[model samples]
Target: MPARPHSPCVEAAPNGSFFHPDVKEAFMNAVTTEIPALAHDAGVPPAPPEAHRTADELRDIPLKRLVASPYNVRRVPPTGIKELALNIWKVGLLQNLIVHPMKVGARKAQTFGAAAGERRRLALIYLFEHDYIPADHPVRCRVVPVEDAVLLSATENEMREPMHPADACDAYRILVEAGRSIEEIADLYGVHPKTVQRRLKLARVSPKLVDLFRTGEVKLDQMQALALSDSHDEQEAAWFDAEPYNRDAHAIRRRFVRDEQSFVSNRVAKFVGVEAFEAAGGAVRRDLFSAAEDAWYRDHALMLRLATEQLEALGASVLAEGWAWVKAMPERDHATRSQFRPVLPRRTEPTDEVAKELAAIDQRLAEIAAQWEADDMDDEVAERLELEEGALSMRQDEIEGSLLVYHPDDMAQAGALLSLDANGEPVIERGLVAREPVAAATTESGENGDDDDDDSSDGRPARVAAPAVKPTKGPHSERLMLRLNAHRTAAVAAALAQQPHVAHAALVHRLLAGEYGHSTEASALDVTFRDHSHNLTKHAPELDDDLAFTMRREQRRVWGGVIPNDSDALLRWLIEQTDERLLLILAQYVAASVDSVRPDERPHAINALIPALGLNLADAWQPTKAGYFDHVSKDRIVDVVSAAVSPSDAMRVAKLKKGDAATEAERLIAGRGWLPEHFAKAEVVRMKLWDVPAKASDAEASADEAEADEPALAVSADDVRDDAAVAEGEGMPPRD
Candidate 1:
């Protein structure tokens, strides 16, 4: 076929250099049949010029090396050093560092350092810090005279790739400090004069951010933007957070210095169809001082113009109407959040009745689906084959009408033949063949025609014979399985519903209620809880006497606990208790129980329970419980706390319990000679209900009796029945 391929061989080139198969192959294919000397020439980019340092003289250098150089110039920057470090880590360093000689009292001595690859130098330093290499290992470095140091450093930094912006800035700083003009630095670095100037501007940035820029944490644009801030403090603060700093480096020097913005206006302005500088200026003007009426007017006019143009383009009548409404709105007026345009045409809310009916329909559909699945295989097969309800019903009608068309025998034969074909290759007829008609016999003759002896001897229709049925083959129909799964779900649900506890929970009634509940409430009220424990003993009936006693005692408590017809002291005690213990209990219940209810139900439930819990305290107390104060009093409950308290002390409570609301008379008078006196009198009318007692105790008997004793004891109803009943007696009226 083809000449056998030669076995591969490897050898050094004839030039006695690096050995490689590709090089050898290329050598064989050369124009003159000689390995080209230029093969390696086009190979690797020159390994950077050998670093001229003493470290280079060492035969075995540590994997990572760091040495200071006398030739170091801050103007030179790291270039391919980061890449060189990565390469050395992966392939091992093949080159040495460069250093320059220093004179100590005229005796020349070499000091080790890196000439090029500042990034590599840092990376090696990182390795040393990270303990990647042994601390004491010596490294190879190349040495040169002190005069060649600057050249070496510059060549090392500049020979490969490019310097980062911060590095470039560093280099420029070195040159400037050395008496080189910005122009001269620009020419040497192959940068524009402005570039050099901009770098110098970067050099003025705070040291923290300058270092961040050096490490590339902050981009050049971000640094430029930070520099543009009008105040150094502001720029430093913004830079500390790495706020969205962006500035056009190419921006005019005057504008860059004057701008205070952190974002590059031009970049975003381009998206909105304007120059960024102008956009930024406009934004600052609009945002900074639109408070004065004149400023507001000017800004409003510009906004109106732009808005008007936008609306005109929409051209829809609805939009125009909306715009008209917006324009007609008053300026600076605050409206309650509830006031809003209607979202839809007003219609009476849906009645609960209709929702119940829809839910019932859903349940019925679930029931029907379940019934179909529980159907027999024959029915299931018919279903799988998609035997429609109407079709199946019609077939049954046809079967009852007469057994002329299909007989059990014919189906059995067809099934057997189908089975034979499935198991092995049954020779099916190549051409269609008509089956012979059965004799003058009963329907049974059509099926299993081989069973001739079972037929009537007279060959007439036999009343006793019926066609044989075939067994269902293969997997059951999917329709049947689906119906079965549905039935199973329903059966389980029904069984769960029928459980004893389900009955105790009135589950069926609840389920029915839920049918109505979902439509009315939009959620089912019935809930199923998994049982983790069972009742150990059957519930026992209480003895009649015990039961009666229990009911009577509960009744007595309920009535006794009612807000008692009491003297003013008793009423005050009750009110205070409601503000404290009763209120807290009610609150805990509301927080736990009421909150568990649906959102719509919660408001209604709370409203119904509010009066029952005696929480209709004057609006003054609402702030104490729901707003800011844990405890508030008449005058002390001002918008701001009027005084501080030590834990062990009791202070006079201020009478202005109604918080910031100025008293009605005081608000009306505004200023009057009698105002302070009237305010003092009003404070006296507000009481400290918290001082009232809840129940009698040895320490609280007088308070409790004063609070809970009947007002009837203080007044004779016959003496002044009508007026006495009007006010609970404390020299006023008898309690109801």
Candidate 2:
């Protein structure tokens, strides 16, 4: 730099007479130009030189003086113009619009043509149209060269990051907290008032959940669901309890509300009617984020009370209709109604006028059906046919219903069951009669031996007992008999376990029975079966909550997972299994099928079987105060304690309160190996001796002596009877 030219970019320091050497050199190199090198030496063509332009100046110009650029790429929607105008009106222009001076002309006298922020320009026009701003209002603008305007507009429109939803929510909330009305915030942000409201709702979510949303751990919809509840505890609980993989909006909402909330769409809620329920002081919780059906009635108890009251009122109306009795319940499906015998409605012949109307309706329905059957029919034609058919069918149904009317006499003896159908419509089950006991037949005789006599000569009918009819049972009632046979089968199973020979014999007998006997009577034992296969109507509630039940359910779940879903694959897998494994599997199946009467049902048979199987009930069954003693009578509790400990111990607890006694009884019976009557084994019967001839009497006596010298085998006549009854295809003997 022998003689460097003065440069504007490089300035001399106050203490120095010349600029810095590096700064001066950089400025000289930037200003100096060089010719291209030889092609052979350069190897490639040189890039074009960088362009230089003067910096644009920002200026405030009149709104009318700024005109939209014809070459602008961004198109602002018409609806957005109003929102944009509101935003501009509230906050003023956030960024200056890029514009260039327009050439002066007769028709075009505007000051500049807008490139960037065309939407802002349109928004200003909107404000002018809406009388919010004067026509010549001043708008901020960046004065750029004409060529740079389109590039600036495209760059401004394309290069920007969207605001994170959480950030936006927080921003909205901050604005709200700063004393801004929702409408004001909406106007400032160019959003709907509802949008602002929703953002505020989201902002009210628990801080922890909001943090999770900010970190992207929770989704937008999930956050919305959490925001449905104002309680921080509920929001946190719902978020934490939700399955990570299945944290859907619905699941999140369900977790937040739980069973405490009942949907308005639910049958019970519909039956009660939302208006009536709310009138009864039930609070209805609506999801601001969802549709109307998503609303829930928070007070379930109040809703139920209202529903019950309405149902009872309906029942009263039915009772007033000369019925013997009326029952109102929440549920009255076929399963419930089947418990009662329905009195058949007396049939009546239709009157001539009604018959003619029914015939005409039926003919019309047939014609409509024929018309509807046309393949080339238009949608309108098909819809018309359907409407006509529906009308005719309704008339037909009315006529048919009128023909089947109950007599007043029958109604007097029978009753009606009132309940709500699936759609919340009233379902009246009429002509339901109470189950009558089966009565015994009576015989009458007169002095002249006439059958029409009311009484005998002694003034009483002879009390002759009716001959007993043997139960002709051959799978008469599958479900009832299955339960009855299950008990007998359990007892037999316990016996057969001790005597493997008996098991083998029973297996062979079952196979033979299948081949020779009826298919339905193939086997008494349900060896291949599943647990909880049959739906039990009656059982202790604790059975469901029992630890053993839970363990069994988990075991079944594991086994079900390992088992092949395809039948063919399962068969193949079974064929591939070792004999020992197969036997173990079979044992599990057999054990699960031993649906010995539940403790609440006829448990005597299972009680008898337990000891025979050498089962230590103490190992499997522990009597808790709530599970056992609490449910039993005080006398039973004392008896249990007495049997387990001593009579004194029993007497000590007998004077205590029932609950205290139960607790004490439980402690006493803990390790005593004592069981309730339902669980205790029945007495084992001994084999009977038979009469022998005198010649063989001495030998028989010697043999009997030898048998007496050996240990006695415990057996039961009831067990033997059960085995016989099973083999004979007859119903089991009644339990004692």
Candidate 3:
């Protein structure tokens, strides 16, 4: 037989340690244990949730007759009682109190214990004490048995949930508008002052954002971030007036404080010092809501004025260097900047100590380089070495420049510029020579007469809108074209390397047009003579099969092995070679300069060069799964299959998945000599390089513009791609 459980004992009344359970006057029933009789194996069913209170009778009990139940579940310090009192006073109690008769000496007692709603009972007492309600104010009560009182109280307290954060904020806002101070509200709710402030902050946010918060469009944290701004107009502007990319919590905070003067981290503010700016009558506002509490500077014009005055003082000090002029420019105009040529100082002999320092730096740099000999290095080590090298190089440059001075003649002909750098340090640029028209560009020794190296500071005023991320490109990315173009460039160079005649014409045409003032004319050969072989290597990847690139590399390898290593020895060897062998090597170098990387379309001049060398790009390259099929869209792969194979084959490939389709297309296009559209289109050109018994005598002396712009064609090779890249941000600087 199972033993029966002991009956539960109830503790007497409750809180500041509110609601003491050990009060002597409170009533609680005595505990008793009873054994149950054995049953015939039929199990009893469970009772409904509200079964304990279903039989209780509703009664209009006077407020004075109700007492807090010792069996009430909540025992915390009395909280929200004042608000509860105010609500009951204004609207009357909406919920009935759960209570039981407290039998005294076997007689019905006038007072009943409130098993639930102890807080409500307290609130009624509060209103009566304050004269807001009568002592015998009628209160609704559900009278239950004394034995069932604790269960009903526990259920009511445990089942309720607190209000939402947004609602709480609005509640606080209501109290504030009703003439309650923040401290009063904090004391009223037993919360801290900052809690009230934060709640009120949300309440004060843009009403549109408030609507967003209510509708779940804006989150609580986002609303809190927005509340940092005080003005409704500014808040709306920060949210709505901002760029689409800039409409986020972090960006909204930045846009609200758009005034340049108040930013404590501004370069000008940092340069002048926040204390100094404030002393100079600049207003500073501290954003307490910000995590870091960063300040904003309010005086834009004042900061600029102070920066200019300080620059003038700095410039005046530099005038002692005997410069022809020293100008202090808060903002250097382009017209003023254009007047002078940039100059790097000439270094004189360094002192013994500086020489040792330079040697130490060189030794360290060599050590790092030696350590970096491995094909792959640790990322941490690489990053550390990069930082170390940068610092060491900067120090080395400073030490090397320490011995530099302007020549007295140069100083007489030049001026110095004084302005602030990005960090707001006053930087002085000395030895800026005025641009002068000269009879010759070279000295008697054939050395360069100019000394310009063209380096300048990123000079600008404070304040910029938050930066936005660049939108992503389509599937046919620039990277794909860059790789393809790199291969094309390599092919053109390799082909040109074999054709010295084409190289000769291009070089001669460029030199004649540049030197002799044929400015108005365009050339069929618009090629520059700068080496971009490194750029070609940099942009292309997976180039083990680029035939022209491989061939050019092999040719370089062969020459590199055959040529004399020493410059003087090489010169002598070059002089000894027959004109044929020498022209071949020289033409190889000239051909390497032929960069024809246009992104999608070929230049009109390059169009002329294509046929000149009998260059066949189709022979040089072919599409493979990895190279072409994988990168293109499914539709494009199908199109390729249709073009290279048959429409039926394309339809079959299209039925397969993307990856499988690409594989099938690669298989179908393998033996077909079909090329992509970019490669298949080319215009025929005609060129007449050398004159043959022209009617005019000057025609022998000079080539005409008509001959250069539109030349007669060489051997034709059709179906070659013209998909080279636009210049990679660098071409020869326009001679203009």
Candidate 4:
């Protein structure tokens, strides 16, 4: 392989250098040699022997006498005329022009139409116009009947190399217009429906460019870039910017390029403007293509690659395991890593086993038929019996026909013999299919003591009775009646009502209509509480837990000493309050002290405690009773409480959600006698410090990933973090 040039593309950066010289050389060599090698490997399969007279027999026929076969039309290559003219001028037409006999009533003005060799027809015209060949050149045209020409043309197109994507799109439209199904067209073209769809997308691109693509002057990747634009003007602009020189050529190769991050960012920023971008309403503050979005795309793409690799590995492993019999299995149905099952050797041929099972099924069918004949029958039952008989026959045919069933033992051993119906009864059967054979004379009655009733004697055959239907009931009463042992519903309700956030709780007289709304009776209690709050507002009253609901002495002592007295800010303050007990519980379960868990854990703990805090329970609680707390801004609570405690201590306290006892204890340790300013600064520095190790770990992982794909020069999380850390360490904020 030749050495790779310092610059592969003309527009590469001045500083850019060859990163993988060996791989680049190999790739270039493969590009030039692979196609011809593949074509040679395919070899030439002989076409059917000539169906009609050779081209020389029809040389005396005038060009004007020939007409095209409607079935054989294909797009003529743009350079085809030149190539054909040259070929004719030198060696003459090596491949004879295939033509059909003209219609009997053809007018004098009628022009010759191409049957198979449209390229040769066009080339002949070019030669004649240039005076390189005589206007009445004795062309060697293959003469065939008109009917055979049509069939030949259709078969030729179907068996040939598939059309280009642009050609495919136009072909699909033609097929559809001619009343062909999408599936039929897809099958005929040997492509997926989705592939056809993408071709259609290419076709939908600007008409002017479609011609360029068809002519092969433009590449697919460049066409993709043009298609990305919403309008012709934008497409022209993007095309000019991406491919300044040889625009048509670039359009053909557009898929090779990726959108530049800086370019996309600048475009968006200009469209929205910096001030408006910042001021955008709720949840629109982030970039349209966010870091999270990019991360998701990368992760998903990586997973897909890994999954494909694993599947390929499993396929190789399966082949190595001497599973030669099933080697021709479809790729789609081949066992994946998760689904891999050992292929055990079988003792008997599947057909022989199925035959044996069928015999036994026949025996059982004899018994069932005898029993049915003994029972009284009706028209409805007779009709049902006929339907069942037909179904059984179909199932038997399927069992016998499917390649899925191999050995007789496979039917039972594979657990595929019997299947439960909708009514939870085993109705569908696979083993040996029980049907008509049971009534045959070869099946002896005394051998199995099974019945054999002849249906031919009577006009009406014995029919199987349908199962009786259950009567329907009215809609369920609007109540949940819980019948319990020992515990009373009222006692549980009372216990629930005594909680700090509960204004009232009682046994709901009627079930709530909506999923989460309180019943009318419980809603009355809320009304009473609201009235009480309104009355107390005159005296600037607040939520006095003692006045609202009684509590145990220990609970009161815990809250009274730690919880703030500002009831007006109870929800926010409650968020700030974190119980030491819960932290200790978490610390014990995780086997880690409060200070040891990573910074991310602080948020996780706070999220866990939000429900225990009795905040945002209504909005956040899902139908399944799981919740996401959002009563107060998490930032606000973290900031306010951090002012009075160490960041580590604050994190622990916030995680607790039980009380603020630990935060108070931290204040005592500092010996700061209400010196809140000092504590605030300590918390900020400590919190920021905890993030350092995490960010460093992320950077390390990213660096490792980038190293694996060393020559690609791809942007990744590690690259971003590496740059960010450098900026931050140098006393500059990281750029977005």
Ranking by TM-score: 2, 3, 1, 4
- For model 4, the superposed segments whose C-alpha errors exceed 4 Å read 1-165, 174-181, 211-218, 222-237, 241-591, 594-736
RMSD of each: 35.4, 20.4, 20.6, 35.5
lDDT of candidate 1 over 1-736, digit per residue (tens):
9976644433433432223446444534533222123223323121223332332233433433345443344434556544444455555656656554322233533224454444556666655666665654555555443334445555565566876767767778888999999877655544568777767777777778788887877676667656644456765666553223222232212232232322222211212222332443443322111122111111333333433343333334422322222221111111311122211111122346644644555465455557667646476555554534445445433332332222333322321110011111211111112244545533323323443343224442221222222323322233322222222222222222223232232333334333221111111112333110111000101111122222322222232223333578556866777344454333222221121111111111122222223222221111222122322233333322222222111121232224222222223222222211111121101111112323457657776545433221111112222432643543311112
Q: Worst lDDT window (10 residues) for model 2?
A: 46-55
Worst 10 residues of 3 by lDDT: 31-40
**lDDT by residue for model 3 (251-343), tens:** 565555543444444555556766767888987655555665677766778877887777778887688878888887654344565566744
Candidate 3 residue spans exceeding 4 A from truth: 1-203, 206-229, 232-300, 313-326, 342-344, 352-398, 407-415, 422-426, 433-736
Could you tell me the lDDT of residue 595 within candidate 4? 13
- Highest lDDT against the true fold, candidate: 3
Instruction: Give residue 90's lDDT in candidate 4 (0 to 100).
Output: 65
Residues 1-736, candidate 2: write the lDDT tens digits. Answer: 5988877434643323134446544533542232112212323222112111222677788998987564355554546887878887887788888876654545755467676777789989989988999978988887765434445556577787788898889999998889999998877778779889888999889999888898999899888888778899988877786446436676566555654545554677778776777787877765778756466766766766777788888888788888898877664344455456766654477789887887888787668767766889998878877787787887775666566666788888899888775467776777788666655423212212343432224433221221222334331133433333333343344344344443444455445443322221223333445343222212223232234443443343334434565799899999998775565555445445544442232222233344435555555546777556766678878887887789998887786667667767877788776654434434332221211212458887887555434432334324644655654774322222
Q: For candidate 4, lDDT tens digit of each residue in 1-736?
A: 9976655433322222122334434544543354324323544221123422232145444544544444354544546467557656666677767675443333444233356777767777787788886666766775644334443444455567866778767777777778987676655545567566556555666777778778976578666546544356655555545434425432322322232122122222222233433343311221121222211011222333333443344455444433332221111221121122222222223477787766655665565567478557777877876676666666654554442323434333322122112222222112222222335423211323323433224433221211222323311111100111001111222223334222111112112211122112111122211112212111211111122211221232233323334677656765564554334222222211011111111111112112222433222111110011122234433443465446775564354332222223333334333322211121110011001111358778676544433321222222322444764764622222
lDDT of 4: 0.37
Return whichever of 1 and 3 wins on lDDT.
3
lDDT of 1 at 161: 83
- How close to the true structure is residue 662 of candidate 1, measured as C-alpha lDDT? 26
Each candidate's clash count: 32, 0, 29, 20
Candidate with best TM-score: 2
